[model samples]
Target: MYRQLHNLLLAAVLEGQLPAGTKLPASRLLARELGIARNTVIEVYENLRAQGCVEGRHGSGTYIADLSVDHIIEVPRPVEAMPARPTISHIAPALSQRGQSLIAGAGFSRRQWGAFMPGVPDVREFPARVWTRLQNRHWRKAAPERLSYAPEGGLPALRQALAEYLRSARSVRCEPEQIIITTGIHQSIDLTTRLLADPGDSVWLENPCYWGLRSTLQSLGMVLQPLPVDAEGLDWLAAGTRPAPRFVIATPSHQYPLGMVMSLARRQALLEYCRLNGSWIIEDDYDSEFRYGTRPIASLQGLDTNELVIYIGSFSKTLFPGLRLGYLVAPPQLAGAFSKGSAELYREGQLQQQAVLADFITDGHLTAHIRRMRGLYSRRRQCLLEAVQAEFGEQFEVIGNNAGLHLVVRLPDRVDDVAVAEAALRHGVLVRPLSRYYHQSVAGQRGLLLGYACVTEAEITPAFAVLAGVLRKFVKATSA
Candidate 1:
C-alpha cells in the first residue's frame, strides 16, 4: 500500500499533474481524504522527500519538489501534436558508405530456421548432454586463463585438435602451429583479406559464389574478378588476358550454392597458376562431408606444395550454425602474423567455449556426430530431389546435388527466380534465388538454392511442394 501510494505520487509529480511548488495536503488530512492511516501517509511523504520528489518546510506542509528547478521531464504529448522526426535522408547519416553497403547487401534472412533454409544444419540432433558435461567441467575449474582473453591465434588445444582432424579427414597439410582458430568462415576470410590483399588488389571470385563471401570482399574494397564456374569448378583465367589476382577464393570440395567438386585437373592448374604468379588460394572446403554415394573430396591445400593456399572451414555446417567456430590453416610464413592480427583486431576471447569444442573434437564426438548426420542429410537431400522431380519433371534441372547441404534447381532463362522465391516466402517457405549469388549480371541461369540438411525427410517433400507450386506460377508467366 505504501509503495503503491508512493509510486502514484511520484508518477503524478513527474507527469506534471502535481506541478512544481504545488503544496501537498498535511499527512493527517491526506490520510483521511484517501481513507488511509496518517502514519502510512507520513511514511509515503518521507519516502518521496528522500527521493527528491517532494520537499517539506517546518511550518508549511509537504510539497511537490520543483523538478523544473533542475532537469525537467517533458510531458507526454498527444499523437497528432507530436512533431515528426527526420528519416535517414533528413538526419546526418549515422553509418559510413561501407557500413551502409554491408547492411544493404546482408545475406542473412530473418527466418533462420524453417523448411528448405539453405546452408543450415539440423541442430536438434546435436549431443547437448555431452556438450554440457564438457562445458561444465571447465566451468567447475574456473581457471583465470580459461576465462581470460584468448591467446594469439585462439586456444592452442583447439588448434592442435583441428590440425590433427584436418590432416586426417580433409588431407590438409599443416602443423598445429599453422592452424588459427576463428569464430567462423567470415572472420577467417576477413582476417586473411586484410592481411594478404590490399584495397584495389585483384581477387578472383568464383561466379555465383556465396553472397556473404562476395559482400565481405566488396566492403573491403578488393577488386573482384568474377570467374565462370562450370561442372569441373571455377574456370579461372580462361581468356589469359586479365592480370593474376592476389587471392583466389574457391569452394573446391563443394562449390557453394552450386555443389560441384572442383576437378583434380582444375585444382592442380589453379595451384600452379597461383604459385607462378605469386597469388594465394582460399579453399573454403564448404561442406566436404555428407557426400552422397561418393568418397570424401580432399582439400586443395593438401595439393599445394608451395603453400599458397589458405584453407578455411566452418563447424557451422558440420555440427551446428550457432557454434560460431571455424579454423584457418595459414601458410607457415604468414601463420604467426595472422595469429597476431586476429588477437589485435578482435581481442579474441571465449577460451572456455573453445576448450569445450576442443574436447568435443578430441573425444571422438565430432567424428561420431558427422557420421550420424551424414546418413540423415543424404536421405533428406534425396527426398528434396525426388520432390522437385515429382512436381516439375523436366521443366527444371537440378544440378549441384552430389555434395553439400544445398543444391541448385535451375529454371528456364525467362523465369524470375527472385520473384518465385518472394512468392514462396509469402507461403511460409524460405529459399535463396540463385541469381542473387552472382556478382556479375549474367544471361539466364535462373535457379533456386534448396537446403535439405536442416529439414527432415518428411518435411522436404511438403515444403518443396509449396516451392514447386510457386515456381510453376513463374514458369507459366515466363512461357506466356
Candidate 2:
C-alpha cells in the first residue's frame, strides 16, 4: 500500500505532471486526505527519499528533486570580462548620510490619467475570495496571543511558507530562521541598512535605479555611489575609487526602471568582489516573476557562497500593494543582530495577515495565483510591446521589456524626456521620466520608464495615443 502511493508519485514525475522541484504534500496531511495510515505515507516518503526522488529538510518541508540531465549546467558566456576590481585597505565608508529626517512616507496615493504606473499589481485580478476564505479559516484557529506581540523574526508559518516558495520559484536556499518579514521593500531596506551599514558608509547603486532605494539610503545619510546600467545591467566596475563600498544594492533579476536582467557573470563578479572586500550585497529582486521568455533567471542569493549577500523581496509587486508584506533573507551572521533589532525596536508582523499568508502558501493558493498571473502579464507585455511597435514605429527604441512591469523607451536624441513626461501628465497619461531614477549628477537620460502591469489592454491604446502626442510635442518644441 505504501509502494502504491510511491508508484503514483513517480508516475506523476515521469509524465511531467508533478514538474521539477514541486513540493509534495506533507506525509500526515496526505495520509489524512487519502484516508490512509500515517506510517504508510511515511514509508512511502522514506522509500522515495532514499531513491533521491524527493528531499526533506529539518523544519522545512519535502520537495520533489529535479532529475534533469543538465542539472549542473555551466555558467553562460561572460557579459564582459570585468577588470580586476580595486582592493580596499582602508575602510571606504558609504558617503550618503541618512538625511536630516530619517522617516520617509511611502504609499501609493497619487491618481492621474493614462497612468502607466509601474511596480503596481493589477488589484482587480487578485483572488480576493480565496484570500478571504483563508483569512476566515486561519482566524478560527488563531492562538490566544494572536492579537498580542509576536516574534521579531516574523510568524513561523509565514517564514516557512516564504522559504518554501523561494526554494521552488527563485531557487533561494535558506531556512525559516533566515527569513525576516517587513512592511514592504522600504522597510526591508531600512532594516537591512540599519543592520549592516553605518551612518556614512559608501553604497553602490545602479544608475537609473529605483528612486525609492536612493530616497531610502540618502535619507539614512549613506553615500550612494551610482553605477551606470546598460542593456546587460549595472556596470560592476563603476563603483569608482572608494573607501570600499559597504554595501551594493542591486536588482539583478530585472533592474528597476531599466528592466534589464543582470547577466550571470556580473552576478558572480559582484559576489566575489563583496567576498574579498567584506562588503555585503543586497539583492533587491523586485520584479523577476513575470518573465515572458524562459523560466525566470535564478536569484543572485541562489549563487552566493560567501554568505555576503542579503536578499530582499516583496509581495506588493506580485500581490497587491495594500498587503504591504516584504521580507529579508539575511546571512547567518546578521540573523541574530536583525532579530534583536526587530525585537527591541520593530517587534514582529501582524498575526492575522501572517496567518492568512501562511494558509495562502501552504494550501497552494500562491502557486496557483502566480501561474494565472504569469499568463496574464505575459499577454499584457506582448500587447504593450506590439502597441509600441505599431504606434511609435521602429524609430522609438524600447529597452528591458523582457521580464518587468516597466521598460525604458529612448526617444530621438532631439526630444526632451522631462518635457515629454510633463506634457504626457497634462494629457492625463502619467509616465515617469527615466532621469528621475538617476541621481542629480547623471540626470540627462532622454527616455520614459513606462510600466504596464497595472494598466488594462483597454487603457493601453489611449495611453499610447496620449504618449505619442506628448512625444510629438517634444519633437516640435525641440525643433523650435
Task: List, residue by residue over 402-453, the lDDT tens digit for candidate 2.
Answer: 8867767887667767777777877788788776567778755778878787
TM-score per candidate: 0.82, 0.76
Misplaced by over 4 Å in model 2 are 1-109, 112-114
lDDT string for model 1 (343-443, tens) is 99999899999999999999999999999899898888888878887987776788988877888888777888888889999999999888888875655
Per-residue lDDT value at 181 in model 1: 88
Q: State which candidate has the highest TM-score.
A: 1
How far off is residue 333 in model 1, in Å? 0.7
| Local distance difference test values of all predictions, in order | 0.87, 0.80
Candidate 2: RMSD over Cα atoms? 24.2
Lowest lDDT sum, 10 consecutive residues, model 1, at 68-77
Scored by Cα lDDT, where does model 2 land?
Answer: 0.80
